[model samples]
Structures are given as C-alpha cells and as structure tokens.
Target chain A: MELLSNLALGFGVASSLTNLGFCLIGVLLGTLIGVLPGIGATATIAMLLPITFQLEPVSSLIMLAGIYYGAQYGGSTTAILINMPGESSSAVTAIDGYQMARQGRAGTALATAALGSFFAGSVATFLVALFAPPLTAVALKFGAAEYFSLMVMGLVMSVALAHGSVLKALAMVVLGLLLGMVGTDVYTGAPRFTMGITQFADGLNFVAVAVGVFGIAEILRNLENEHDRQVMTKNISRLFPNRDEFRQMVAPILRGTGIGSVLGILPGGGAILASFASYTVEKKLSKHPEEFGKGALAGVAGPESANNAGAQTSFIPLLTLGIPANPVMALMIGAMIIQGIVPGPNVVSEQPELFWGIIASMWIGNLMLVVLNLPLIGLWVKLLTVPYYVLFPIIMAMCSIGVYSVNSNTYDLFAVAGFGLLGYVLSKLRCEPAPLLLGFVLGPLLEENLRRAMILSRGDPTTFVTRPISATLLVLSLAILVLVFLPQIRKRRDEVFTESDA
Target chain B: MSTKPKDGTDIAAGLLFMAIAGFFAWQGLGLDMGTSTRMGPGYFPMVLSGLLFILGAVILFKAFGRPDDEPMGRIAWRGILFILPAPIFFGLTVRGLGFVPALFVTTLIASQASLRMRPLAALVLSVVVTIMSTLIFSYGLGLPFRRFGPWLPL
Candidate 1:
C-alpha cells in the first residue's frame, strides 16, 4: 500500500505538464548527441548538463535522468545500424546487431533492443522503488568509518573493472584524487593547489573538467582518423518482431534483467559489466551457441536488456547512499550538488518528491524511448551521415557555452583547455579515464570521511576494522584487489576485455 | 638498443605519473602536514602523491622485458593546436567581445581542427551556430549575457 501511494505521488509529480515537457526535451536532445559518432552517453550528458541547470531541481533532475536513458537507447541504434557502438556497454550489441543489419534485419535488431530495454527498464524501475527505501534506512545508520570503507571499496571496484593494467588504473585513481584536492581545504580555509589563482580557490570547475576530459578528449580522438562511417540504413525491412523472434528474446530478456538488477547495485562500472556478462551468459546457454556473433537475436536482446536494467538500477546506490555506480552517475551526483541537494540518505527523507519523481520519470522516459524512437529511426540514420568535422565544431561551441554559463568564470574555460590536453595525453598513454573521473567525484567525500572517522576514533587506525560494516567492506576490497592480481584471473580478465574490444 | 624489449607506452606513462607526483609533493610541502587524526590541508594529498610515485615506479619497473610493444597510435596534433585553444580564446575574449562574437570566433577556430573543413564552410557553419546559440541560450533561456559588450563600439 505504501509503495502504491509513493508511486502515485511520484507519478503526480512526474506527469505534470512542465515536468513531462522537460523530460521529453531531455530525451530528444540526449538521443541526438548520442546518435552522433564518437560521443558516448557520458560526454553527451556532460555537454548537455548545463542546459538542465536553469530549470527547477525536480524538473532538471528528471530531465537529466531522461537524457541518460535516451542516450543509451540512441547508442543501441548506432550499434545496430553502423556496427560502431557509441559506448562500451553497447559494444556487445554491435556484434550481433550489426550482423542482423547486414542480413536485412536491422529493424528487427533495433526493435529487439528497444523492447528488451523497455521491459528491463520497467522491472528495474520497480526494483529501485522497492529496494531504495530500505537501503536508505540502512545507509542512514552508517558512520564515518563505514562510509570511508565503502568508498574505498568503490574505488577498488572501479580499478578492478577498468580495462588494461591494474597499476595504470590505480595510478589514475590517485591522480584523480589529487585533482579533486585542488580546491580549498574543506576543514580549513587554506587553498591547497590554487597556485595563488584566487579564482580557483573553489577548486576546478566540475563541469569544465567533465567536458574537457570526456567530451573534448573524445573529439580529439575522433580527429585522429578521418574516415567515413558505414551506415546500414537501407535494409531496415520490418519494425516489429515476428512470433519466433519474440519467443527467442523472452528468456534472455528475463535472464538479462535479473543479472543486471543484481550487478547494477554494485558500485564501479556495473552497467558495462552487466552487458558483457549477459552476452557471455546468453552464449553459454544457447542451444546453438554457434549462432552468437552471427546475428543471433538473443545476442541483441540479452545485452540490451541487461544494460538497460543495469543503467536503471545503478540509480539505487545514488538514491540511497549518495554513491555513484559509474561515471555517468557521478555526473548525476555533480548535478545534484549543483542543485544544492546533498547526495545521501537524507535526500530520500528530505526530498521525497525529487527522489520519487526521478523514479517515476525513468519508466516514463523508457516508454517515450520505445514510442518515439522507433518512428524516428530514419532521422537518426540520416544524422549518422553528417560529417564528423561539422559536428565537432558544434560540440565544441556547446561545450564552451555550457561550461562558461555554469559560473560565468573565465578561469573555468581555461581549465577546460588544460584538462582537455591532459586527458588526451593520458588516453594516448593507454590510461583509462573512467577510474580517474570516479575518483575525482568521490575524492572530497573520501577525504572528509577518513578524517572524520580518524578524529572520532582518536587517531586509532584500527577503528575501521573494529566497525563491522567497515571491516566487511575493506575485506571485500582486499579480496577484489587480490583477485585482479592473480595471474590466471588477470589473463582471463584481459581476454574478457579483448573480446569486448573486438 | 637495450637487450630486452620494453612496453614504451607504460614507460612513458610511468614517467609522467612520477613527474606529476613530484610536482604535487613539492607543492604539498608548503601546506601543513598535520597529525594523522587531525589532518591538515596537505596530509591526504601528500599520501596520494607518494602512492602515485610508487605506482608509477612499479609500472616503470614492470615495463622492461615485456614481449611486445603497444604502439601509441597517431596523435591529434591538429586537434590539439586548434581545438584546445578555442576555449581559451573564448575565455580571453568573451567579456570584451561579448557572447555572440566570442562564440562565433570560437566555433570558427574549432572548425579548423579538421583537415576536411574548408574556410568558407567553416565561416558559414560558425554564423549558423552563433545565431542559433544566441537565440537558444541568450534569448530563449534568458541568460544574462550581453550580445555585445561595452568594448564593442556598437
């Protein structure tokens, strides 16, 4: 009864004319940018983030949530039609989805992706509504020590999930932590790394850093090779799945949704892993496993559903604990902070409408994706043909305006340039930026909790171990570190990443 | 050449990390390094910098004797030259030249990052982008930005 009443309240807020309109705009814009080559959901959201800032908190956050889902759906469209996934999570989709396109089933692949995502999204939204409240209650009881250990676990998980060498990812995390420390000390008024520039006393602008590292670095990478994208737009013959195709998708979609809901709650890149895991599962379970990578309907259905489910449930951690499950969620946390909402258990109790409104909007946004996007596939396919050179300039201009409008600070724009170069260099050196971005977002919180816990314990380092929750979390982090380092596991990890890369 | 093969990318990355660590450490030394319980401004950063240095050193050490090298692919020299400066130019000129002109020039500068973009196309694109941006951000959103700043004779 309480759940139903909460749902009613959420629907009441989300379906208001203004909120619905904002949500629609967010979904449309997110898809537009995400459909373009060389931009992922993270960069699309980062570039479009400032546009949402001008709205009321509820509407802005609702819009942002819409953008996230919409971008992901657009990514699937690109994957199926062009074989070039806009994001890594959608890479698995491209394998079979593109094959399907070539086999003249592009419409079926796209339809499968849309339907699977909607089903998984609906289930995951309900799961979030079901699980988030209880989790928030538990999180409300967390002390500084537990929070500190949890963040440590989150950081370690990010490193574990990151592609390539663990050492590089760890170094990236440390580097990000340092960058996060650049602003004035929170406990004390001392400027830590301002380099005597008074304008930077508040620290590097988050929006600037995000736009530079994700958006600008991405553009530079695309510019490295000027090539035409092969669009498979001509062979889209059918919009709806036949009975046999629908039957084949049903089991995988169910399994993928289940797997994704569980994994999505884990901090540090759960959605990416969820999709990969779903692909692997579907392959192993298929009666004709050989059909995988050869236009298997299950391949397109499973990962799409898993990833959508993962993306939706990833919000649970943020909603309940104020901890982001991935980089995109980190950006959402940043948006919340900009809106003056402290991201934690307090948000649930304090801003019930904002919390529930977002939950309600997720389902609404997913519905819009299925309803509006299927009809608009031709338009997105046309957008795919737009020259890369033309798009980058528009993106750059938007990035500048977005970052500048945030604070009207000239220093922020300069920071964007500097970070863009730094990001490009780091990528060139084969370092993953996701871990770095995660660490940057969590840096201040980690430090604050560590210091507070230490002071509370009267400088006893053992207090972390003494606290049961903290001890368990730290143990999990240690176990993960050891698991990643083991020779056999490391090789297998490399193989998984390589498979996804191909 | 060295007797053993080394991962050049890792080697470069390690050195870069170490250099950054050294810089942070040097800067952090100026701030107070309070006791562990009551950390001053520099304590956490100092620890992170040291950790980074060690990680970098380990990466460097491991790079040697690797079987093969992972080539660092082509760099975006043109993009760096043009794209990186576009924002900095806007930062320097936005107030003086105002939003419309500043955004226009920024778009024009960024369009040159690609070899395929011709000068005439770039100009036309900038005009369209600037107009649309001004209309959307300045007028539609009602952001308090002057179309032309006081420095403009107009």
Candidate 2:
C-alpha cells in the first residue's frame, strides 16, 4: 500500500513535461550512441555530466539514468546487425545475434532483445524498490572497519574477475589504487601528487580518464582497422517472434533476470559480466548445449535480459549505499553529488520524492526505449550504411568537442591523446581496463574508510577482520582469488582467451 | 613450422615504465610527506611512486618470461599522425580561432586519417561537421562559441 502511494507520488514527479522531455532526449541520444560503435554510455554520460550542473537534481538524475539503460537497448542493435558489440555487455549478444542476422532472422533477434530488456528492466526496478530500503538499513549498520573491508573485498574480486594473467590484473589494480591517491589528502590539508601544478591539486578527474580511455581510445582503434569494415546488411523479415521463439525464451529470461539482479549488487559486477554469465549459464543448463553459438534465441534472450537487468540493478548500490557499482554508476554518483544530495541511508528518509521519483522514472524510460527502438530499427540499420571514413571523423570530432566542453580547456585534449595511447597499449597487452576503472572509482572511498577505521581503532588493523560481516566478505574475496588461480580455472581461462582469436 | 624472431616490444614497454617509475621516485626525494596526522603534500605521490616501482618490476619480470613474436607492424603510423596533432591544434586555436574553427580544423585533419575517404569527401565532411557542430553546440545548446579575433565588431 505504501509502495503504491509512493509510486503514485513518483509518477507525479516523473510525468512532468520537463522531466519527460529530458527522459526522451536521454533515451534517444543513448540509442544513437549505442548504435554507433566506439561511443559508449560511460563516455556519453561523462561528456554530459558537466551539462547537468544546470539542471534540477531529479531531472538530471532522470536523464542520466535514462541514458544508462537506453545504451543497453541500443547496444544490441549493432551486435545483431553488424556482428559488433557497442559496449562490452552486448558482446555476448553478438554471438547468436549476428548469426541470426546472417540467417535473415534479424527482426526476430532485435525484437527478442528489446522485449527481453524491457521485461528484465521492469523486474529489476520492482526488485530495487522492494529491496533497496532494507538494504540501506543494513548498510547503515556498517562502521569504518566494515566499509574498509568491503572495499578490500571489492578490489580483490575485481582482480580475480579480470581476464588475463592474475599477476597483471593485480598489478593494474594496485596501479589504479596508486592513481587514486594522486590528489590532495582529504584528512589533511596537504597537497599530494600535485607536482606543483594547480590542476593536479584535484588529481586526475575520473570522468576525463574514463572518457579518454573508453571513448577516444575506441575511435583510435576503429581507425586502425580501416580495411575490415563491415556494415550490417540483413533484410528485416518478422518483427514479432512466433510462439515457439517465445516459449524458448521464457526460461532464459527468468534465469537471466535472477542472475543479473544478484550479480549487479556487487561492486565490480556490471552488465558485461551479467550478460556473459547468463549466456554461459544458459548453455550449461540447455539440453542441447551444442546449439549455443549457432543462432540460438536463448543466446540473444539470456544475455540481453541479463545485461539490462544488471544495468538497472546496479543503481541499487549507488542509490542505497552511495557507492557506484561501475563507471556509469560512478557518473551517476557524481551527478548526485553535484545535485547536493548525499546518496545513502538518509536519501530515502530525507528525500523520498527524489528517490521514488527516480525509481518510477526508470519504468517509464524502459517503456520509452522499447517503443523508440522498435520503429527506429530500420533507421539505425540505415545509419550503418554511412561509410566509416565519414562516420569516424564525426565521432572523433564529438570526442574532441565533448572533452573540450567539460573544462573548456585544451590541456584535457592532451590528456585525451595521452590516455588514447595508453588505451591502445593496454589493449595490445591483453590487460582489461575495466578493473583499473573499478580501482579508480573505489580508491578514494577505500582510503577515506581506511583512515577512518584506523582512527577509530587507534591504529589497529585487526578491526577489519574483527567484524563478522567484514570478515565474511574478506573470506569470500580470498576464496574467489584462490578459485581463479586454480589450475583447472587457469585452463578454462586459456580456452576463453584462445576462442576470442578463433 | 619456421622459427620466429623474438619480439622485444614487451621488453621495451616494460623498460619504459621502469624509467618513468624511477624518475617519479627520484622526484619524490625532494618533497616532504609528513606524518599520518598532519599529512604532507608529498604523501600520496610518494606512495604512488613506490607502487609504480613495484609495478615496473612486475612488468619487467613478465616481459622477460614471455616468448616474443614479431612486432605488430610499424606502430600504426597513420593513427599516430592522426592523434598527435590534436592537442597542439586545440591549444593554439581554442582561444584564438574560437571553438568552432578550432573544432572544425581539428576534425578536418583528424578525418583525413581515415583510410576510407577520398580527398573530395573529406573536404565536404569537414564543412558539414563544422557547420553542424556550430549549430548544435553553440546555437542549440547555448554554449558560448567565441568568434575569431580578439574583439568583435557588431
């Protein structure tokens, strides 16, 4: 009864003319960026972050959240049409999606992906509303020691999940932690890593680094493969799936939503992992696992549903605990901070309207994405026909303008170029950048908590292990690390890497 | 199968990182990092330098352990050329040429690196991109686009 009343209030806020307009714009832009390869939601959100400074807090959050999920919807379009995943989460969708495209079932694949995403998004939103308050109450019980332990566990899990050599991942994680330390110490007035430059006083802006590494670097990579460009060429046939297709997808969507909702709560887990894990789980559970990479509808349905669910539920950590589960969430956190709303336990109690309003808006946004994307499929397919030469320059221009717009400073341009080079090198070395990003996002929070815990404990390190919850989280992290390093797991890792080349 | 020559790309990269770490560590010697209660300006950088040193050592070790293959083709000069001139272009023209011209010139040069474009299309693209950006960013979004030169005569 309370939920319904709160939702009614939320609807009143979300359905406002201005809020609805921004939501539409966000979804439209998100889909456009998602359809275009190399431009991702993280970059798009980062670029738009500064602009939101002028908006009302709720409207800013509403639009930003819309873009986040809208990208998920748009990402699958390219995966199905051109055998390319716009974002990492959509990569798994490409496996069967592209195959379906090849077999001229492009319309069916797109429809399944869009509908599955909408369903999962709706379920995840409900789950967030149902569970977020209780979770926030639970989180409020955490002390400094517990917070530090949670960050440590998050860092360890991130390292364990990173693809490639465990040693390399660990190194990157440490490097990211070090990078996080490059600004003025919060506890003391001392400036660290400033190198006498005023700009370094604030440390490297995470948004700048994220935009540069993911967005600009992607454009550079696209330019490298000029000769191998492939536009999506499938003709659309059926827009709606038949009964058999629907029947085949039911279990996958349900299982995927469950998996995604759970994984999305973890700090390092994002849409990419959810999608990949869903596809893998679906394969394992299927009676005919051999049909997985051969244009299985389950492939499209499971990952697509999981990706959207994960994307939606990742908001849980941000809204409830004030912790961003991934880069996009981090951007959302930045937006919230800009809006002067400290996201945590008190967010619900203090500003019920904003919290509930944002939650309700997500449902409306998800519906908007489906309605917007279905008719626009043909248009997006047409967009693919634009030659890479013409397309890429415009992308690069957008990257330049977006970066410049953030500070109106040219130094950031240099920073983008520097990160671009670094991104290219990292890609060649098979080191995943996602873990580094996670480390970057978590770094300051970890340090602040560590310092606070130490002060509270009077310099005793045992506080982290003394608390039951912290101890449990630490033990889980260690177990995951050990599991990842096992010889059997190592062999599986090798197979996954080798298959990419194939 | 024929034997492949050992590739030194990893070793070079590792060595470069080590050099950078070493330089930063050296620089850290001149700064005071202070105690835990009254943290000095150098606290974080000093910590970063130490971690970077460890990362350098790990990278070097990994590079030594790997079996190398041939270098991956001439360091992709086209991409390098396309990306390198951007900062200089932005720095010089951002305040002087104003946002529109600077953006236009940068996009024009950057687009020229595209392997798919002929000279004719590239020119048309630069013009279109410049005009579209001006309209969307300046006119539509209400961002202030500075026109060329110091003072504008109305």
Candidate 3:
C-alpha cells in the first residue's frame, strides 16, 4: 500500500502538463544528439544545463533525465544503422547492430534494440523505486569520516578502473583536487590560487569547464582524422524481428537486464561494463559464437537492454548518496545544487515528490521513446547524414551562449579555452577524465569531511581508520587497487578496454 | 611489475605533474599551514600537494622502465585554430555587435574547421543560423541578449 501510494503521488506529479511537455522535449533532444555521432549526452546536458536554469527544478530534471535515456536509445539506433555510436556506452550495440544492418536486417536490429531497451527501462525504473529508499536510509547513517572514506574509495576505484597508467590518473585526480581548491577557503576565507581575480574567488565556473573539456575538446578530437562516414541504407526493411529471432533474444535481454541492474549501482562505467559483459556472456553461451560479430540477434538485444538498464539505475547513486558515478551524474548534481536542493540522502526524506516523480517520469519517457522511435527510425537515420561541419558550429555557438549566460560574465567564456586545452592534452596522453571529474566534484567535500572528522576526534590522525565504516571503505579501496593492478587482471582489463574502445 | 620506460610522453607528463606539485606545495607553505587540530587554509592543500608530489615521483621513476612506447597523437590544429577563436570572437563582439552578428561571425569562423565547406555555402548557413538563433534565444525565449550590437549599422 505504501509503495502504491507513493507511485500514485509520483504519477500525479509526473503526469502534469508542464512535466510531460518538458519530458517529451528532453527525450526528443536527447535522441537527436544520440543519433548524431560525436556529440555526447554529457556535453549536451552541460550546454542545456544553463538553459534549464530558467525552468522549475522538477521540469528541468525531468527533461534532463529524459535526455539521458533518449540519448541511450538514439545511440543504439545509430549503432545499428550506420555503425556509429553517438556515445561511448553504445559501442557494444554497434558491434553487432552494424552487422545486422549490413545484412539488410537493419529494421530488425532497430526493433530489437528499442524493445530490449523499453523492457530494461521498465524494469530498472521499478528497481529504482524499490531500492532507492533503503539505500538513502543506509546513506543517512553515514558520518563525516565515513563519507570522506567513501569518497576516497570512489576516487581510488575510479583511478583503478580508468584506462592507461594508474599514475597518470592519480595525478589528474590530485590536479583536479588542487584546482577545486581555488575558491576562498571556508574556514579562514583566504583565497588559494585566485591570483586576485574576483571570479576565481567564487570558484571556476563548472559549466564553462565541463563544456570545454567534454564538448569542445571532443570536437577537436573528431576533427583529427575527420573520416568520411557513409550510411549504408536509409530505409528500414522491416520493423519487427521474426518469431525465431525474437525467441532467441528473450533470454539475453533478461540476462542483460539482470547484469545491468546489479552493476549499475557501482561507480564508473556500469552501463558500459554491463553491455560488454552481456555481449561476452551471450557470445560464450551461443552454440555458434562465430555469429556474434556477424549479426546475432541476441548480440543486439543483450547489450542494448543491458546499457539501457545500466543507464536508468545509475541514477541510484546520485539520488540516494549524492555521489556521482560519472561525469554526466556530476552535472546532475551541479544542476540539483543550482536549484537550491542539496543532493544526498536527505533529498528523498525531504523531497519525496522529486524523487518519485523523476522515477515515474523515467518510465513514461521510456514508453514514449518506444512509441516515438519505431516509426521514426528513418528520420534518425537521415539525421545521421548531417555533416559534422554544420553540427559542430551550432554546438559551439550553443556552448558559448550557455557558458556566458551563467554569470553574464565573459570571463567564463575565456575559461573554456583553458579547460578545453587541458582536456585535449589529457585525452591525448590517454588519460581518462572521469577520475579528474570525480576528484573535482568530491574534492571540497572530502576536505571538509576530513577536517570535521579530525576536529571531532581531537585531530587524531588515526580517526579515519578508527571509525569502523571508514576503515572498511579504506580497506575496500586498497583491495580494489591491489586486485586491479594484478598482472592477469590488468591484462584482461586492458583487453576489455581496447575491445570496447569507449 | 615490469619496470621499463613506457614512452617519452609519460616522462613529459610526469615532469609536468612534478612542476605543478612543487608550485602548489610552495604556495601552501606561503599560506602558512597550521597544526592538524586547528588547520589553516594551507594545511589540506599541503597534504594533497605532498601526495601529488609522491605520485609525480612514482611516474618519473617509472619513466626509466619496460616497453609500451607510442608517439603522442596529433593536436588537430585545425580545430584548435577555429574553435579557440570562435569563442573569443563571440565574447569580444557579443556585447558590441549583438548576439546575431557575433553568433553569425563565430559560427562562420568555426565552420571553416571542416575542409568540406564552401564560403558561399557557409555564408548562407551562417545567415540562417543567426536568424534562427536570434528568433529562438532572444525573441521567443526572451533571453535578455541584444540582437544587434551598437557597432552594426541598422
């Protein structure tokens, strides 16, 4: 009865005219970006975040959340149709989906992806409603020391999981932390590295930096080779899979949903990992593993479902724990803060409608995507043909407008160049930006929690370890680091990374 | 662990990290780190800087070791040339030339980054983009930006 009442309340809030309108727009825009390869949800969200500042928190969030799912769905469509991924997480879908397209079964591939995603989204939305409250209650019990340790664990795991050398990632994290400390210090009010600029006193503009790093830097990367992309076909042969193919897909979709549901709760690339894991599992379980890269229906179904499920459930951490598992979630946190709502365990207890409403909106968005996409598959394929030339400039213009609108200061616009350069250099060095972003988002919180815990324990250095939860988290981080660095595991991880190439 | 130089690039990155670490450490010291109990603004930074210093040292030490050497990838100067200037021009002119002209100029410049664009085509594209953006962002959405800068002749 409690769950039913909660669902009723959520639906009441989500089904309103404004919420539904924004949700539709969000998903539509999300799909557009997803269909157009090279532009990612993170960059799109960052650019749109400023515009969202004009709307109500719930509407903005409903739209942004829709965008996330829509992008996922859109990315799959591109992958299946043209062998291009709009985002990294959809790489696995492209592997088999493109094969299906080449075989003149593109319609079946698109249908499978959409249906699998709808199923996964429905299940994961239920999972969020089921699990979020309990997780929030657990998070609410955490102390400053525990939270600090958890951030450390999150950072270390991010570093361990990141591609390329561990040292580079760690350095990037420290560098991020240092950069995060640029604003006026809370306790003493003394500025660190502000260099007398009044703007830095408030802290580096997050939108400018995020758009620069993820958006503009990505544009630069795409321009390097600027390879010509060709669309094999513009027409869908059939909209539905044959009964035999549908039956084959059932087990993989279920299995993918299961993997994604569980792993989606973890930090760093859960959706990506889930899709890849499901793909591998499906391949191994297949009687004809050779058919995997050559258009196996299960291949498209499994990863598509897994990624959608993973994307939906990845919201769990941000909603309950206030910790972002990736860059996009970090932007979500930033958006929440801009709305004057602190993100964390207290959000559910205080703003139950927001939580339940977002959950309900996600389901509605998924249903809309299913209905909206199947008939519009041709339109999306046509969208893929838009040259990068026109697209990138429009994107850049939007980025400039978004960054400038934030503080109405041109200073932040200039900051974009600096961050873009840094983002470019780091990516060039093969260093992952996830760790740096995690560090930036978590840095100040980590320092504050550390100070509080130490102060509470009379400045004892052992306080971090003496607290049981903190110690446990620290040990877990240590264990992950050790295991990740093991030669066999490292080699396997590298293989996975290289294969996914996300 | 296999100890051998991975690449010359890592060495360069390592030194960059070290230089940054040393600068932050010096700044922290200048800020006057207080005791652990009643920490000053400098204390947490110093600790972080110290850890960074160690991380940098490790990378530098690893630079003398095992196998995987690859050249640093291309810079995509075409992107750098256009993308950087696009924003700067927008910022400089957005206030003076108004959103329409600034956006028009910025978009036109940025479209040059792609080798496939013709000037006449880009010019037409810029005009459509500017008109649409002015209508959408300024008139429809009611964003308080100017449509035309003072420098533009009416």
The candidate scoring highest on TM-score is 1
Give the range of the ten consecutive residues with the poorest summed lDDT in model 1 chain A.
A43-52
**What is the per-residue lDDT of model 3 for residues A1-502, given as tens digits with 9 covering 90 to 100?**
8878898889888999999999999999999999998889989998899889888899999999999999999998888777878877888888888888888888999999999999999999999999999999899999889998888887887787677787798898888888788789888889887777988888888888788888888999998888778886745778888989889999999999998888787766578778888899999998989998888999999999998999999899989989887778888998999999999999987998898999999999999999998998878878877888878888888988888887777878888878888888778877777788778888888888888888888889798898898999999988988888799988887887777663
Off by over 4 Å in 3: B1-6, B65-69, B150-154
Tens digits of per-residue lDDT for model 2, A50-130: 677668898889999988888888889988898888776888888899888888899999999999999999999999888
CAPRI classification of candidate 3:
medium
Q: What does candidate 1's lDDT look like per residue over A8-60, in tens digits?
A: 89999999999999989988987876688687778767766787788999999
Provide the TM-score for each candidate, comma-separated: 0.99, 0.92, 0.96
Ranking by lDDT: 1, 3, 2
User: Where is the poorest 10-residue window by lDDT in model 1 chain B?
Assistant: B64-73
Order of models, best DockQ first: 1, 3, 2
| Model 3 local distance difference test score | 0.86
Could you list the chain B TM-scores for each candidate? 0.96, 0.79, 0.82
Which stretches in model 2 have alpha-carbon errors above 4 Å? A497-502, B1-20, B30-48, B68-74, B149-154
CAPRI-style docking class of model 2 based on DockQ = acceptable
